[model samples]
Target: MKIIAKNKVAYYDYEILETFEAGISLMGWEVKSIRANKVNLKNSFAYFKDLELYWSNAHISLYMAVKGDEQRTRKLLMHKSELKKIHFKKTTNRLTLIPLSLYWKQGKIKLELALAKGKTKYDKRQSEKAKEEKRKIEKMLKNYS
Candidate 1:
């Protein structure tokens, strides 16, 4: 799988509970833009409407030679069971679905959806501290060896 773009901030700001892969609906120019490596998943999220999934806020730059919608709401295709489960989690568990990455799988574009809960301020601080501690440990080990 060739990853096109990744939402690095999602990892820092959310606690991921699960992940699912879903196919994306794209237009001709949108797909072309992606092939040119012009897509962003940093602030994109998925939502359910009419029992169908739609993704918004993901930016796919307009193709230079083709006039197309730059940031259209793209549909996400998933199995009925998966969609139902995600809807349930969103409603009952209060979890959010964020698009973590966009990649090509066997010539088709696929999105990796992360089932995540937003991190509190303290949780962010704790994660930062843990990362710092790990860095320090690695440095100490390197110097001692």
Candidate 2:
């Protein structure tokens, strides 16, 4: 799949437990905007309202050539079973539905959503420490070799 836009903050703010790929419903202008790589999923999230799943806070810039509303809520297409699974995890496990990335799969736009739990400040600090230590070890090994 060819990626269009990615939400980098999602990885830093939450611990991703599971990921799902789902189709996106977009207008022609929005599709064109995405092709030009003018989309942002950084502050976007998924939610189910009235048995339908929607993505909000995702920005698709105006095509400039096309005229109309630019910031509309986009619909996410997923199987009923998948929707049920996401709902269950959200309600029972206190997990969040975060949009991780947008990509082109077989010419259609798809969204990658993750079941995530927020990380605490201490957790973030420990993760940074672990990463630094691992990097130091890798550098040391490279130098010795």
Candidate that scores best on lDDT: 1
Q: Model 2: clashing residue pairs?
A: none
Q: lDDT tens string, model 2, 87-129?
A: 9888899999999989999889999999999999999889889
Looking at model 2, report the run of 10 residues with the lowest lDDT sum.
64-73
Looking at candidate 2, what is the lDDT of residue 111?
92
Best TM-score goes to which candidate? 1
* TM-score, structure 1 vs. true: 0.96
- Please give the lDDT score at residue 73 for candidate 2: 80
Model 1, residue 90: distance off in Å is 1.6
> lDDT scores for all predictions?
0.93, 0.89
For candidate 1, give the lDDT. 0.93
